[model samples]
Target chain A: MIEVKNLSKTFTSHVKEPGLKGSIKSLFSRELVTKDALKPVNLNIEQGEIVGLIGANGAGKTTLIKILAGIVHPTAGEAKILGYTPWERANEYRRQMALIMGQKNQVWWDLPALDSFILLKEIYQIPDAQYKYNIEFLAEILMVKDQLKTQVRKLSLGERMKIELMAALLHNPKVIFLDEPTIGLDISAQKAVRGFLRQYQKEFKPMTILTSHYMEDIKELCPRIVIIKSGEFVYDGSLSDVQKMMGDEKVLSVTTQNGVFKVSVPRQDLAKKTHELFEEHYVLDLNIQDPSIEDVIESIMKNGIGAT
Target chain B: MKWWKDVMGMELRKILAYRSDFWITFLGQTFIQLMVARALWQAIFETQGVSEMQGFTLEMMGLYYLIAPIGMKILNGPNFGFLAQEIYDGTFTRYLLYPLSVFQYKTLTYLTYSLFYSLQMIILLGIYRLFISEVAFTSVDVGHLFLGLLLFIIGAIAYCMMGMMIEMIALWADNIWSLAVMLRFFTSFFGGALIPITFLPVWAQNILVWTPFPYLLSLPIRTIMGLSTFQEVTQGALILMLWTLIFMEGVKLVWKKGQFKYTGVGI
Candidate 1:
């Protein structure tokens, strides 16, 4: 449902020195500098698949999403979401897709969420019957039915987010792009959003791409993970494969007569290493397990995935 | 069509939600302006010892001040500060995500604000007419009145487009508040909303006539007051339409170029 080929975006900004002199100088001659926000990124997301986009700050995950959502045009290459060129911004493309930015708001701040919902209804040209059903279902799932009448500014962050999600989904979009949807929310609120997204994806089978700093959001909702660094994807595979990429590293715990000792070793060397240790010491209990996802991701983030 | 109507309805509700602010900005502020202009014009006519100044009788002066505020509303439309804020803060992403055009959305919003503003001015004028005894109502032909209203709508659109172009400059500049203030002062002084264009020096009036600023406020006011001949009104309307097209093209060009620089920063 989504395809991106060599999709890249470059941002150019003017550099000013300082003070009144610099300001005047800038007016006369602006020093232009270019930064690559995204570098020839490629990804293909199939229908009914939910992919987690993981990257450090300024790693181009959000840039990639914005490019696919048509908010920012690419400086080079192309991207198509559900068979429509996103940058062209065709009405059919917009109607069948939705982009939800957690830090940004789509609802009118002073008006009730229901009012914004009504506006979205017209915006997406949803049929009356379908709009009613979608709102009822989405509101009930997000547990914001009673809160829809209150002004958005008065609602809790979680409540507002629920309403935002409802607004994006009112048209029953075929593709969804979520950027930090769970950021700044309480744990329960985060859980609610993650749970809703999981169920929503299951029911609708829409291709979804989500970016969040929260590891739990990635672990719980995304079966396939795409990790990028420095404007390029370094790893793209299942959650378990990421551990394998961390290289056969397992945490080995041994409870001997001298208490317990924990050591890290490759999976291939575990048997020989453990046997040699058993011969040298009195081993009481031993356990071998792969490193946690967090440890692997941390190592990937600190050092490039290629290093792992 | 439904999308435009929806935006208009939502903007109306937003204005109603801040109805107190509406009263303060439109009624309280406009009342002060009218009183000040009335006092200034009264002193000028009294000092000159003449019943008329620049083809305006004392009653016509009173009528001009009465209508100037309404003309300002049409010429100013709603402030583009909201659009500027959106562009600066990166919330403009919301509009890009939606299927509707940002231009259409903002235009409809202005139209809604103008509708509410016109209603409020009519009510205020109704109240004023109850106490005033010698106010002149211009005897305009029906065809001319319709033509004037059409010209007024087109002129409002021109102002809106011009405002949008200025606000879109925020994508390049750090702050635009000063620019907006300067624009407001320029329009009020040279657009002939603060004083009659005929009262200005001949050279200044001649230059102002060549530009679109006067058509936005002064031409409509003069057309309604029957101060303009039918030929002048026709020519002014054509010039105003031409300016609207130019500003509309400018808006499109600025917005398209501005998007390339938009990193969706801040928000």
Candidate 2:
């Protein structure tokens, strides 16, 4: 449903040195530095696949998504979504896709969400029957039925996010780009959003590309994960493969007679066996076994010191 | 039809939802315009007799100021703030994702606000005309007034389009406030809010005559004041139509070309 090829975006910024005199000198004779937001990134998203784009701040995940969403013009390469050149922004192309940024609210602030949806319905030219059905479906799933008539500003954050989601999906777009769509929400709301997205994707079979800071969202919702760092694609495949890329550093956080004892081991099986009953301390206490993603990521960042 | 109806409906919904604000702003803006007209009348009466200024009689002057709010409703509605906002916040992408063009969106939104506010202006004008003795209603001028209104709507829509075109400069320009201030100042100055454009210097008046700014408010007022002939009204309408087309192209080109350089920052 979406194809991006050799896509790259570079931004030029004026380089100025420190101090007032240096700044004054640089103001007249400034140097230009080209910062690559995305470098030769290529990807193909088939219909109905939930792909998670993962990276830290300034990691180019959002940049790549914006390029695909037709918001940012790429400096080089090409992209196609739903039989249309995204950058062209044809009406037919627009009718087939939606982009939802979590930190951003799309609802008209002074008006009810329902009113905004109605305007969108007319703008998108959705059939009345289909519009009603989709609204009803999204309303029930997002649990925003009661709040639909309330002004967007009066609604809670979760309710507002649901409305934003409803507005994006109102036309049942064939492709969806979610940029940190679960950011700043409570855990329950986040899980609810993930569940709703999972169900929506299953039902609609849309091509979904989601970028998020929460690795759990990517781990649970996306089968395939793409990792980016400093404008380059580092890993592209399943979630565990990304974990394996950090090496077999099975982290075991043991809570025993001591408060906490964390071990960096090579194998999970051996760690679990040791934690079972085979090995015991003099005053054995609580035994905890978990190799969280944070430890793996920290290891990766530590290893990627000079690479950046 | 589909486009206009949707935009119209959006405007209607907005008025209904904020009916309190609708009434307050409507009255406040009308009163402000009325006072400005009254002050201008006092200044003219001090110099001249009970007769008209230029070709505008005292009664016609009252009527001209009375109905200028109708033009104001269409021309000076505050929708350009949203354009500046969308450009700054990067939510403009959602606009691009719509089947409607950005031009269509702005046009529809402007039309909506005009229709919604026109009703309020008409009601206020009706009340003043019925109750106030000084409020003019040369009664038999309905046909000309109606014709005048038809021309005014075109001028107002054209001016709003130009406003959007100017506001879109916020996407690239460092000083959006200056652009907005310039637009407001020019629209009122050339469109004849301070004085009837006929009274301005002939050279300045001739230049204003060629542009669409005067037609936004000045032409309709002149028509109401009986200072212009039917041929002049028709000519004014044609100039407005021409300017509307020009601003439409301006909007199209600015929006299309501007989106390319749009960084979509702050998302």
Candidate 3:
């Protein structure tokens, strides 16, 4: 189980003005500014559960992940993962946890992925049987067995990401923190990664916290979602609960001979609105659907938690 | 021990990835420096019309120049900017996540490079002894050689810690490259890689002896060449060890404080 209480992170940086004159002046006297990257937030995640963190850029998603992963120190609050404080960086705790960042790679670029895996095996001290089995199983599932022998720098982005996933999962961590793991991949590659992750989670039953911009990833993999805005958690619940909180609204789209119209209406008024649109124009096609997860998230991001 | 061996193997593979590049750079730099030293020293000797200066004959000076570079190379180890660059780019996050000590890993990497250069030095020395005539030192004393090897290892480790100490400044400084370059220059000049310490004035030599620079290159070469006594090498070892301890402490303190400042994002 992961328990976080009043966790926060604040970054302080010096402000520099533009131009040579300002640069020289600031060297003698400068102003410092502080920004709260993460506010005091509380969260609890249980084993075998995958929680999706939804937020816009600079919304503290990554900061929260970094804090929990022990990569960054929190300004305030306490967090216990599997009964261990992460920032202390105990070996037993680190051994059972894995942090994978999509934008950054941990593999050595100049060497084959297998070489890096060997080094990791030594670092983690996995038994021969377990290490060999994991290597085979992860390679087969991710479908990058051939590419493992190639240099990481030589592999395509998709292949490299697969190798990275395999590397992170080699120890079969009990807790996984994935930060935009599918970013910058093609649609097919994205699907492949999602499929692999889903299977891995099912087999290992590790607690996973994933943050991504792709709604499909959340919709397909996560049963629970948390929305963060400006360094705070605005809403935390299942997708259906959030949709219901939007007050029984449905999106209506009508394509007529002249043009296509799309709008949102309350569920009770959906039928009347569709009929009125059909009567007003020569409708070739019409459809009524629930508001997209993307729309709901965008609205929540723009407004406060009560916007739903 | 097995883990260290595996890591060392990986480091070796990385070094061998571009064989031609490594060979060209290593050999080219060594020979070019030797050539320049040879030209300058020959001119000085000819103009002075003397067979010897500062207790070093022309042959001894040539041998000194040849061995000094290898000694310095062994001490310098691999690139020290690795940690600083990783900190600047936010890639240092990986080290935090790994269940191993970053300092230990870096020290091992440095040792691997130093060991490889030591091997080159050995092979070069053997070749020179076998092929060249008029070798300056005819006989090798096993005791002196052993002492020299010990001091070489200590000096290399000391230099590694010093490099890391400079690199930890990346936690606050925007750029550490200039500082690193400055360290390299100071080590080469003060350590007597550029010119023999014996050629310097007595006052300058006395001042440098108290510093860690001479143990890094000059003293080690002189010890191996059978010019320095066992007592002198022992004293130098003690001083280098003290310096290494200081650097180790500085690195630890910086790392402890720097963790709070790290945002895990590129600066």
Q: Regarding TM-score, does 2 or 3 come out ahead?
A: 3
Tens digits of per-residue lDDT, candidate 3, B25-92, equal: 56777667777898899899999999999877777777778778888778877765767788889988
Clashing pairs in 1: none
Model 2 spans > 4 angstroms off: A13-33, A252-290, A301-308, B1-3, B47-51, B79-82
Q: Chain A of candidate 2 scores what in TM-score?
A: 0.84
Whichever of 1 and 2 has more TM-score, that candidate is: 1
TM-score rank order = 3, 1, 2
Candidate 2's error at A112, in angstroms? 1.6
Q: What DockQ values do the models have? A: 0.64, 0.51, 0.65
Any runs in candidate 1 off by more than 4 Å, and if so which? Answer: A15-31, A251-289, B132-150
In model 2, what is chain B's TM-score? 0.87
All candidates in order of lDDT, best leading: 3, 1, 2
lDDT of 2 by residue, B115-216 (tens): 655566556667777876344666425666567667667776887778878878877762387677777778777887756677789999878767777888
Could you tell me which residue pairs clash in candidate 2?
none
Q: Which candidate number would show the highest DockQ if scored against the true structure? A: 3
Supply candidate 1's per-residue lDDT for A136. Answer: 85
- Residue-wise C-alpha lDDT for candidate 2, range A134-197, written one tens digit per residue: 9999999998889988999998888888999999999999989999988899999999999999
The DockQ ranking, best first, is 3, 1, 2
Question: Between candidates 1 and 3, which one is better according to lDDT?
Answer: 3
